[model samples]
Target: MARMIPDNEAKEILVLYYSQHGATRQMAQLIARGVEQAGLTARLRTVPPVSATCEATAPAIPDSGAPYATHADLEECIGIAVGSPTRFGNMTAAMKYFWDGTSPLWMKHALAGKPAALFTSTGTLHGGQEATLLTMMVPLLHHGMVLVGLPYSEPELTSTQSGGTPYGASHHAGVAGELPISEHERKLCIALGKRLALTARRLNA
Candidate 1:
């Protein structure tokens, strides 16, 4: 069995996500940066892409970016920020798959009362950004997590033509996936992470 992390160890905010074509991954990195800016450690982790073939499997360790998340990561985290690209108005299969397998954590109430946040990226301007963010909250809610969202006070929510929303931070990557994250979107993402971290800290304090 894997050893459990000690409660006395430094607290971490788990930045968990799955990205395809890298847009969502970029957002994840920005959120992690925000988490650190708030003076907490951000443990970046990703879920492996799901393959159609049942027998096919990813290598135990990813070749780059964040390491694959473990149950321990979820259980030991002070808060969580989850992200994924839009998949028909919902989180990607890979992200959903990861949460689906966390029944053990649910059974133990491992995530109950912890603060959680969400983010997403989409290919087009109307491509279900808010829907995906809302749906992403379902699993977190099932885990009994306290939901956190971007409030309108964060000016980006009112001004962004791209993908900043009150539900959570988002990015409009364009249909060709050619566009970079906009300045407003970036600020909202960072703000969301910092907010989540601050909430976790106060709750634990």
Candidate 2:
């Protein structure tokens, strides 16, 4: 497959996610902003939703939003930040489906030693935000990725009533999924990206 990104640059960080109602998408954009602020390029990519029909397939190009993520994206980026709306305290099936096909990369250790971070959005304040974040780390660990997470020094971790955690950045959307991302949650998302980018840069250097 052709490269989605230019070959010269090795400073790009991949922001990969699957969003159902836009909350996670917003968070992904904010994270990208942070990554840019830290002097790295952010390659925003999304996975196509998994369909129930065995033969159903997505178009080569997405109708809107970021283009679908390719394994090449995972291999090309120096770092990655993964996001998803929580599903029963775990990543959405679509997100899981994307990672499930990455065994080829795992075999090659393509992502080993790369920095990775996680972010998640939930339908309720008590929904599985932290659990989703923790579970998301499993695949990255399998690939030998160095996990990056929010530190207590961010302040938002202690102050945020909505959603912020040491596990990773998180947002507590209301039951209707209408609540805006809280200020603390937004800041933490950006911080996570910045921290991940900085870590990746240092490791790459």
Candidate 3:
């Protein structure tokens, strides 16, 4: 039997997300933990809240928790795992708005060939968790990223009653975002992160 050799030059993986009610943030942290478990560093980042008014702007820095993501962060990461709460069966406007600003990086092909994964939290079991994950991958695909998804081989996908999908990890947060992440959902999240990191490391090598 051959022993596996780990990549020695793996770049940091970025776990970026936007959460209106904090559920998605918790999922991001769990994914980050999974990435670290795979022996890769995780750089967590969040986007600023969007405003309905045309002239409104967020402060230069967030009040607490992860800092706002920048183009530089995207450029430097080797792998990326993005998460957002489902909004009308798609990613939130804040996350969409953030990706809209990445044209420069796209043009430069800064993210080409990198490994990327998606995750989401929804208000209900049928609240389009899979659609949100698929939709979130569009921009990343346009940027030429390699999409990483959870496989059916993961037992949680077959057994989970709440939220776990082949598209990516998901959580059912209920209408008020009051539901706790189920045991299966958490395991799936960690699995997604670990798989993503391992894939990125191999590809980078």
Every candidate's lDDT? 0.89, 0.90, 0.89
Superposed by TM-score, candidate 2 places the C-alpha of residue 188 at a distance from the truth, in angstroms, of 0.6
lDDT of 1 by residue, 1-205 (tens): 1123455789899999988899999999999999999999999999988875422257879998899999988988899999999999999888888888999988888888899999999999999999999999999888899989999899988998899988889999988789999999999999999999999887887
Where in model 3 is the C-alpha error above 4 Å?
A: 1-10, 53-57
For model 2, residues 30-92, the per-residue Cα lDDT tens digits are 999999999999999998887765322678798999999999999989899999999999998
Clashing pairs in 2: none
How does model 2 score by TM-score? 0.93
Q: Write the per-residue lDDT of candidate 3 for residues 22-101, one digit (tens) a residue.
A: 99999999999999999889999999888775222679799999999998888777889999999888988788889998
Q: How far out, in Å, is residue 173 in model 2?
A: 1.1
CA lDDT, candidate 2, residue 104: 97
Task: Give the TM-scores of the predictions, in the order they appear.
Answer: 0.94, 0.93, 0.93
For TM-score, candidate 1 versus 3, the one ahead is 1
What is the TM-score (0 to 1) of candidate 1?
A: 0.94
